[model samples]
Target: MTKKGKKGPSVTAKAEDRHWHGKRVKARAAKNASRTGSKTLGPRKPGSSRAGAAQGRAAERSSGATRRPDAPELVHGRNPVLEALREGVPGTTLYYMADSDERVREAIKIAADRGIPLLECGKPELDRLTDRAVHQGLALQVKPYRYAHPDDLLQGTAPLIVALDGVTDARNLGAIVRSASAFGASGILLPERRSAGVNAGAWKTSAGTLANMPVARCTNLTRQLKAYQDAGCFVAGLDAHGGSSIANIPAADGPFVLVVGSEGKGLSRLVTDHCDLLAHIPMFGHAESLNAGVAAGIALYELARQRHT
Candidate 1:
């Protein structure tokens, strides 16, 4: 059985062995990576659901509708989160730092009492979640907001309703919502395109007033204005050089629709034509105009005062 200078095995066999070993190593590494990647969002600690709820969450993550159009989705900052929780805003999850402050602790307690899922994350994670907007180590995941149809709003006996033409700022929309709520307007009418919806920024700016207020999305602002006019609503559009002053309008005492346009462009030609009258807030000073939010607030306050008087 002894052979002189015989190699243990053929070079081809050694090469095949090394190739097989490399493949095995790669398979092991891939399996490890898969396990690690499963926990990319972080570890599943206590209070983190892992049953059907987890599966449903996974499904939501996989589906395109995880963040619905109407939902609030993300709300940051302590006041915003605290106010949202206090206002009973539907929260899906509450992301907070493990080492947080008193305000954050209060928010955490409220979220826990409300049965919201609490996920502990770091500051960097919070920053990433909120697009680096000073989250203050807290973020709330809210449910989608339910938007009302244009026709649905007409059914109510709202004395005054505000329709936005092209005010695209979310803060403006939020401020308008607050003003509308304060002045006892029925709801807000927003165009589906080229206008802002009730997003997180709007919700935060609204100070949780959006929870009580209903917003409707209109397909065509001009058509909606015309419908309001046809339904006996005095549709008045706001313009800098409007023919009549807001205080001089007698129709404002009755059920009317206040149409506010964008800050820069004012009302469009079609929307302007649909208005029963153009009402301007007279200013003796040199200031030409006010922002959409300010103008709407002043208009609403005026209308409310007239109605109360």
Candidate 2:
């Protein structure tokens, strides 16, 4: 007889190997699940094949992985899109569906006049572009805002700067920018994180003031404050509980940076520590605190008055 071919592993040995491999896979999956807090682990059962995918999607959404912070903003709705175009909010593209309302037609005309490219798409495409927001067959893709440098705001002999700390609301940011422009602020300073950037809401709320206002973003608000201080600018933070009123700050006459915090939390501890002084807006009413935008406006008006006087 011919030499017997090398026998393959018996069925019993093959089954044992498969059992150990499955156990190792399950062990590794369990370890990963424990670390990630994910309930779906290991190879999913045939009956629940979609469960793992569903869980992964949920995780991504919860972590904000789907948000594109750098993407060009899409201003939706006929009225809003038309207003943005009218306000000269720089835009790259105008997307719309046919048979739109008068507002949409007006937006298209403005976009054409401004030389912004127009893309006529279907309702489904509009819906996708606007993330299913109420687009009303209109959407304008706004150009990404260009932020100024913190040093750029240090222009003029006595430059006035408005810095926001933890002011997350885009509307509040817009309102602050409006006030800053009115009060002769050199520019607006925002921390790179935990602060609102100039977006569609801010553009609407600013009433087009953003077109003129130069906004800057910094990596560290505290370090920026120190730098401002070194540059002979007084850094005053707005706080509900402070030693002195904002109007009474002695450094109001010189170059100043007015740091405004969120309406609810006031200022963060780190920011407060870094400030040269903490000032409160004096109020006679029983109200606890003013809105961040309102408070910033009041403080800025006071500072402007000081400078003129």
Candidate 3:
């Protein structure tokens, strides 16, 4: 039968009929063996159709089926590995290249302290483990990151929220999280679509600051920004032109949410329109633009400085 996307094996009543018939034949064979008092194993009495279906489902679950899509987690680099161990990121194993540097040696000590198994391997093995990322001589296997709900960040007191708009690079996301954590932001918000989600690369890039920072995902970033504005929080978007200077924004001292855009594409029109103010970092150099992480760090530092002073 033709499927929605492409044609493949038939998946219908005929296929199911064949499966049940095979089960019935096996049941008869088991009954014959029991009647003859044979040493061979025999099947238990079959149940109703409904019971059989439920049992099948239970068996599948008991077998630890991978029904959900879960991404693998691998944290690499000396700083990330050390930080992950310090933050208790639930590492399963640690890998260090042979003839490692002092940093990797220190990592091994920490891993041993935590009772995590360590493997000394060559560069090729480390490369395969980290998927060719810059491992810097150390790697750690970690569990998938758990993200927070948007409402979790909005409760209780007003928060300093940093929202991302279409930032697809995982490394950029991690760097932003590190900066946000350092600057006292309550949490980082990411849209459910068209944005990078937290992953091993991001976790590594954050230098394990991701363990402390709560990342919340939103269905619609613009809609959420509007809700924040309604709740007396100033909503601001960062852009390259025609906006208030980040250093002088009065809202920086108050409850505020900063929306940062992708490096290639600035904020989407819908997101930009929802902002109460569009702000930009003052630039005098010949460079036209800054990296997404750098931009976020600068804006966060300004807001933090304003709040402190």
Model number with the top lDDT: 2
Please list the C-alpha lDDT of all candidates, in the order they appear: 0.70, 0.71, 0.70
C-alpha RMSD between model 1 and the true structure: 29.1
lDDT of 2 at 64: 13
Q: What is the lDDT of residue 138 in candidate 3?
A: 84
If both were scored by TM-score, which would come out higher, candidate 1 or candidate 3? 1
lDDT tens digits by residue: candidate 3, 37-149:
12111122344768756754553333211223452467777887888788776777888886547778888888899899998888998776665767787888776667776
Question: Against the hidden true structure, what lDDT does model 1 obtain?
Answer: 0.70
After superposition on all CA atoms, what RMSD does each candidate show versus the true structure?
A: 29.1, 23.0, 25.7
* Top candidate when judged by TM-score against the true structure: 1
TM-score of 2: 0.70
TM-score of each: 0.74, 0.70, 0.71
Error of 3 at 36 (Å): 95
Between prediction 1 and prediction 2, the one with superior lDDT is 2
Which parts of model 3 are misplaced by more than 4 Å? 1-71, 98-100, 120-123
Model 1, 1-309: lDDT tens digits are 112332221122221233233432332233212121111111123343456356444533432121454443588888888998887777899999875478899999999998999999988887767667677888898776788765545544334779999777777888899899899887799988988777676777787888888788877788776666555466777776555567765555555788998765678888877776666776655455577888899889988887788
Candidate 2 C-alpha lDDT tens digits along 1-309: 111232211122221233233432332233212222222111112345376457434533332111355545776777767767887889899998886478878888999999999999999987776556677888778777888777778787678999999887777888898899899998999998877778766775676678889898888889878777666676777766555567777657667788898764567888877776666676765565677788888999999999999
Candidate 2, position 1, lDDT: 10
Taking all chains together, the TM-score of candidate 3 against the true structure is: 0.71
